[model samples]
Target: MSIYRKDIYVFDGDRPVKALIRSYTEADFEGLIRIQQESFPPPFSPELWWNEEQLGNHVRLFPEGALCVEIEGELAASMTGMLVNYNPGDPDHSWVEMTDAGYICNHLADGNTLYVVDIGARPAYRKLGLGKWLMLSMYEVVVRLNLQRLLGGGRLPGYDRVADEMSAQDYVQAVIEGKLKDPVLTFLLRCGRTPVRLMADYLDDEESHNYAMLMEWRNPFLPQES
Candidate 1:
C-alpha cells in the first residue's frame, strides 16, 4: 500500500505534465529496472543494475522507503532506502555492506537513520524537480518517524577528470565551496544534505573514481543532543 501520495507537475517544453509520487509496489518492478538502465547506461557495469531479487526485497522489507514518480503511468524517477542504527564512530563502510548488497536484508525496524541506497531519474526527466520531490518526501518520513537523520553516499561523477589534479577530499571541499560542481554531490547539497566526510572505495564506479561523499540531513524536528 502507498502510505503517501502526491500529484506533481513537470514540464515538457512549455506544457505541464502531471506526475504522481508514491511508494513503490510490485507492479512497478519493470519500470524501476528501466529507470536504472537509463540512469546508468552502457560502459557502466550492467551487473550493478537492479535485479528481481533486490527489487522484491525492497517491496517486501521496506515498501515505504521504495518510492517512484510516475508520469502517465510511466516511471520518471525512483529512490530506495532503508532504516539503520547508523554508527558515526565507525562511519566508513562500503555501499555493498551498508545496503546489504542491494538486498536491504539488514533493514532495522527501529533504526533511527534513513539510509538512501540509490536514487535516479530517467534522462528525459532530469532537472524536472522530481528528484527533489522524492528526497523531500523521504525527509517527511524522517520527521514523521522521528528519525535522527537521512544518510546517503553522494557520488562524485565529476571527480575523475580532476583526480590527478587534486585529492578526493580537496575535490569534495571544492564542490562544497562552489569551486567545483559535481552532478550527484551538487544535487544532494542543493537538497540540504551536508558533507559528513569523504568516503573512499565506496563503489566501483569509474566516474566517481570509486569514492562517495557521506552526506547527512538532520531532522530539525528532533531535539539536539548535548
Candidate 2:
C-alpha cells in the first residue's frame, strides 16, 4: 500500500531527504485524490480535480504549473496554486479558463497578480514549514510569470450570529479545522499580501454571507522586461 504522507519538503535547514516537491500530473490522479480526501473534510471529487488539474475546462486550474510532493512515489502533501495568465488562450476565439487571472478580475481591477485560491497541507504534516515552503513556491511562480501580485479568497460559513465577534483569521481557521476562523487574510498578510476589503454583515435566513477578505500582493509594480 502506498503511504502518501509527509510528501512535501520545506526549505528547512535540514533539507528534505525523504520528500520532495513534484510537478502535478495525470499519473498522480489516484494518489492525489486519496491525499486530498484525507486532507480536507469535503475533499474535491476525483473527477473534478482530475479535470481541473488538466485544464479540461474553459476555466480552472488547467494552465497552472501546480506542484505536489510525494515520498517513495506516494502522494503525501500537495499545494493547489496557479501561475499568471494573460488569456486562457483563444486560438479559435476560445474563452479563457478561470484561473488566478479570472479570480482577480472577479474581485480586483485588471492588473498583474497571481491569486492563490487555496493552499493546504494535511494536518499530520503541519508545522513542518510546508506552509512557508508553499508560500516561497508561490513567490517563484509569481516571479516566473512576471505577475505583479497574488490574490485569494478566505471563505467563511456565511454570516451568522456566532460570527458577530469573529475575525478574518477565525473564519479561515473555521474552514480548515471546522471550528477555527478564516485564515486566508492573515496568512496573506504574513506572505506579504495586503488586505483590500474587510466588511461584515448579516445574511438572509438560512443562507450565510461570505465576509469576503480581498488581498493584493504588496508590490503591484513588476518591472516589465525591456
Best by lDDT: 1
**Window of ten residues with lowest summed lDDT in model 2:** 87-96
RMSD of every candidate to native, in Å, equals: 1.4, 9.1
Model 2 per-residue lDDT tens digits across residues 1-226? 1111224444436666466665566666566556655654532223323333332221233334355665555666665544443322212111123342223223232336565644556665654555656666666666655666565544343434455676545655454454533344445556665555444431111223535554555333465332
User: Once superposed on the true structure, which residue ranges of model 2 sit more than 4 Å away at CA?
Assistant: 1-17, 42-64, 82-111, 156-162, 166-182, 199-209, 218-226
Number of backbone collisions per candidate: 0, 21
TM-score of 2: 0.57
